[model samples]
Target chain A: MRIGFIGFGEVGYEMSKGFLTEDPQAQFFVYDPLYEKEETQQRAKKTHATLFSDPQSVAKETLDVLFVAVPAPFAEDAWRSIWSELNEETLHVDLTTASAQVKQRLGEDMLNEKRTFIDGAIMGALKVYQHKVPIMVSGTGSTSLIDWGKSTHMNLTYAGDLPGDATNIKFIRSIFTKGLSALLHEVMQAADKLALDDIILDSITRTMDKEPFEQIINRLISSNVIHSQRREKEMENVIDFLNSHGIEPQMTKATRDKLKMITQANILEKNQGDPPKDWKQVMRLVNCT
Target chain B: MRIGFIGFGEVGYEMSKGFLTEDPQAQFFVYDPLYEKEETQQRAKKTHATLFSDPQSVAKETLDVLFVAVPAPFAEDAWRSIWSELNEETLHVDLTTASAQVKQRLGEDMLNEKRTFIDGAIMGALKVYQHKVPIMVSGTGSTSLIDWGKSTHMNLTYAGDLPGDATNIKFIRSIFTKGLSALLHEVMQAADKLALDDIILDSITRTMDKEPFEQIINRLISSNVIHSQRREKEMENVIDFLNSHGIEPQMTKATRDKLKMITQANILEKNQGDPPKDWKQVMRLVNCT
Candidate 1:
C-alpha cells in the first residue's frame, strides 16, 4: 500500500506513525512547507517516511490514499496544488479543522469521473488516539475510507453521504464540548479561589454522572423553557458571587444572557406556564419564535 | 414536629406536601405576601398548613424548624423581620437562591449563643425532587438540619462549617450546569436549523457519556492550557458556521473569548510547552498569573 500526506505536522506525523504499526511494508510519501525544519525532519526519520519538496511531487506518486492534514487556512491551497497531479483512484481525505463550507467547496472542486473526496473531521485528541482517533467522514468517498479503515484499525464513522456533513456535525458538537470545557474551567477557577476545588469537582462529577446524559440533557432543556426567568435571576446571584471573588464571570454571564433571552421569548407564556415535555418541544417552540 | 415556612410558594408547598407523606402528624406554618391569593389559599388547604399574615406570625410560633424560602432579594428582609421573634432553639434554614455573601451575612447576623443558622442551598429541581431535592447546608446550624434530615429523608449534604459554604458551592456549580444548559440549547437550536437535531443530540450524548465525567473534565482542563490557541481558532470557525446558519452563537462566542483569554495568559509557555498533568496544575498556573 502507498499513502501520501500533503502536510506533515503533528497530526500527519502521528497518523503516519500509527499507520506504520498496522502495515510495516506500506510506503509513505509526504510534503510539508516545514520539511526543512529539524523537528519535521526528525519526525519523518522516526516514521521512515520519504519526504517530497512540494505537494505536486508527493501527488505524482501512485498513492492508495492521500490525507490533507494542513491547518484550516492552508487546506484549500494544499489540496489545489496536488489535485491535478493525483491519481484519480487515490482516496482524498481532508482532515483539516476547516469550516464545513470550506470542506463542501473542496468536495465540489474534487468532483470528477473517478476521484473520491472524503470530508474527515477528527473528533478526538490526536495525541491520545493518534491515527485511531475517532474520525467522522462524509462525502462520496467515505465508504472507501471506511472499508480501508476496517482493515487498518482506523477509528472511522461515516456521518453521511454529503460532502460537509461530517464537519457540520463536528462544528455543532464543538458548540457543546468547547463551551463545556470553558464552563468547567471557570467553575474550577472559582472553586480554587474558594479552596473548595476538590469538593466542588466531586459534586459536579457526581451530578453529571448520576444519570444518563440523554436524561440530563432532556431535564435541563425541558425545564429551561419554564424556569428560565427564575434561572436568569439565580444566575445574577452567581455572577455577583463570582465577581465578588474577583473572578470574571464570562461564561456565567453568557449563561445569564442566554437565560434572559429565553425568558424574554416568553416561552412559559406561550406554553401556558408549563414545562415542555422534553428538549424537542422546547426547541420547536424556540425555533418558531 | 413544628415547621414554618416564610414563603409559601412552589418549594414551600411541595416540601410541605412531601413532609406530610413522611410524617403526617407534623404541623406546618407558612407566610407569604401572596397569602391572600387564591392559589396560595388552595395550596395551603391542600397541604393542611396554617397560613400566617406575616413573617413575624410564623416566627412567633416557636417552631422546631424555620425555612426561609423567599426570593434572594427578599431573604435578608424576611430573616430580619422574624429573627427576634423566633425561638433560639428553632433551626433557621435559609433556602433562598442568594449569593454566598448574602447567606454569610445572614449567618453572621444570626450568631447568637443559642440560635442555629443553617445556610441551605437547594441543589435540584423542586418539581422533580420536591422536599427530597439535594440540599447543601453550612454554617453553625448545619449539623442540626442534617440530623433532622436523616429521619425525614431529606437529601441534605453538609458542605462545611462556614456560613456561606453551601451557597458558595452551589453558586460555583451553577457556573457549569447553567452554562452547559445554555450551550446545549444553542447547539440543539443550530442542529434543528440544519434538520439534524437527533443526530447531533445523539453524538453529543455519546461523547459526554462515553467516560467518567471526572476523566472528561480532567482531559479538557489539562489539554486546554496547551491547546487553547488552536481551540480559539476552531471556535472562530464555529462562530462563522453558526452565524452563517442564522444562530446567535452566544455561548460559542463566550467559549471562544474564554479560550482567547487562556491563550493570552501564556499558560503553555509557563508550562514549558507541555500539557499540565491535570486540572490542578492548570489552575495553579492560572491563579499565579
Candidate 2:
C-alpha cells in the first residue's frame, strides 16, 4: 500500500505512525513547508515516511490515498496545489476542520467521474485517539474509504452522500460541546466566589452521572418547557446570588433569558400544560412559535 | 410526633403523604390561603391532616417541626404570621426557593438560643421524588432535622452551619444545570434548522455518556483553557454555519464570546502552553485574569 500526506503536522505525523503499526510494509510520502524543522524531521523519521518540499511531488506518487491535513484556512491552497497532479484512482481526503460550506465547495470543484474526493471530519481528540480517532466522512468517495479502512484499523463512519454532511454534523455537535464548556467555565467562576468549587463539582457530577445522557437531556428539555415560568424565577434568584458574591454571571444571564423566552412563548399553554415526551417535541413547539 | 405545614401546596401535600407512609400515626396540621380549593382539600383529606385558614393555628399546635413551604414572595408573611405563636421546641424549616441572601436574613432575624431555624433547599424534582426528594439544609437547626429525617425515609444532606449554605449550593448548581438546558435548547434550534436533530442528539449523547461526569468536565475545562484560540476559530465556523441555516445562534454566540475572552486573557501562554491538570487550576487562572 502507498499513502501520501499533503501536510505533515501533528495529525499527519500521528496518522502516519498509526498506519505504520497496521501495515509495516506500506510506503509513505509527505509534503510540508516545515519539512526542515527538527520536530517535523523527527516525526518523519519516526514514521519512516519520505518528505518532499512541495505538495505536487507527493500527489504525483500514484498513492492509494492522499490526505490533506492542513489548517482550515490553508486547506484550499493545499488542495489547489495538489489536485492537478493526483492520479485518477487515488482517494483525496480533506481532513481540515473547515466549515461545511467550504468543504462542499471544495468537493464540488474537485468532482469527476473517476477521481474520489472524501470530505472527512475528525470527530475526536487526535492526541488521544491518534489515527484511530473517530472520523466521519461524507461525499461520493466515503464508502470506498470505509471499505479500505477495514484493514487500516481506522475508526471511520460514513455520514451521508453529500459532500459536507460530515462537517455539518461536526459543526452542529460543537454548538452543544463548546457551549457546555463555556457554561462550565462560568459555573466554576461562581463556585470559586462562593468557595464551594469542590462541593459544586461533586453535586453536578452526581446529577449528570446518575442518569443516561438521553434521559438527562429529555428531562431537562421537557421540564424546561413545562416549567419555564418557575425556572425563570429560580434563575433570577441564582443571578442575584451570584451578583451578591461579586461574580458576573454571563452564561447564567443567558440561561435566564432563554427560560424567559420559553415562558413568554407560552409553550406550556400550547402543550396544554403537559411536558413534552422528548426534546424533539420541545424543539418543534419552540421552533413553530 | 406532631408535624405542621404553613403551606398545603404540592410540596406540602407530597411530603405529608410520604411522612404518613413511614409514620402512620404522625399528626399533621396545615395552613394556606388556598386551603379551601378542591385540590388542597383533597390532598388534606387524603393525608388525614387538619387544615387551618391561618398560620397561627398551625404554629400553636405544639408540633415537633413546622415547615414553611410557601412561595418565596410570601415566605416572610408566612413566617411572620406563625413565628410569634410557635412553641419553642418546634423546628422551623424554610423550604421556599428564596434567594440565599433572603434565607440568611431570615435565619439571622430568627436566630435565638432556644429556637431552631433551618434553611432547607429542595435539590430534586418534587413531582418525581415527592417526599424522597433530596433536600439540603443549613443553619443552627439543620443537624436536628437530619436526625429526625432518618425515621421518615427522607433523603437529606447537611450543608453547613451557616443559614444560606444550602441555598447557595443550590443556586451555584443552577448556574451549571440551567446553563446546560439553555445550551441544549439552542443546539436543538440549530439542529432543527439543519434537519439533523436526531443525529446531533445521538452524537452528543455518545460523547456525554462515554465518560464519567468528572472526567468529562475536567477534559472540557482543561482543553478549553489550552486551546481557546483554535476553539474560537471553530466556534466562528459554527456561528457561520448556524447563521447560514437561518438560526440565530444565541448560546453559540455567547460560547464564542467566552472563548474569545479566554484567548484574549492569554490563558495558554500563562499556563506555559500545557492544559491544566484539573478544572480548579483553570478556574484559578481564569479568575486571576
Q: Show where candidate 2 strays beyond 4 Å.
A: A21-24, A32-54, A80-84, A109-112, A125-130, A264-275, A285-289, B21-24, B33-54, B80-83, B86-88, B109-111, B127-129, B264-275, B284-289
Separately for all candidates shown, the number of backbone clashes (residues 3 or more apart, or on different chains) is 0, 0
lDDT of 1 by residue, B196-257 (tens): 78889889888888999999989888877878898998899889888898788889989999
A217-263, model 2: which lDDT tens digit per residue?
A: 88888888877788888788787777776666667778888888877
Whose DockQ is greatest here? 1
Instruction: Give DockQ for candidates 1 onward, in order.
Output: 0.75, 0.68
In model 2, which residue pairs have backbone atoms overlapping below 3 Å? none
lDDT of 2: 0.84
Q: Which ten residues in a row have the lowest lDDT in candidate 1 chain A?
A: A106-115
Off by over 4 Å in 1: A33-57, A82-88, A125-129, A264-276, B30-60, B127-129, B268-275
Worst 10 residues of 2 chain B by lDDT: B80-89
Q: Please provide TM-scores, in order, for all candidate models, with all chains considered together.
A: 0.89, 0.88
lDDT of 2 at B41: 88
Top candidate (lDDT): 1
Per-residue error for B64 in candidate 1, Å, reads 1.8
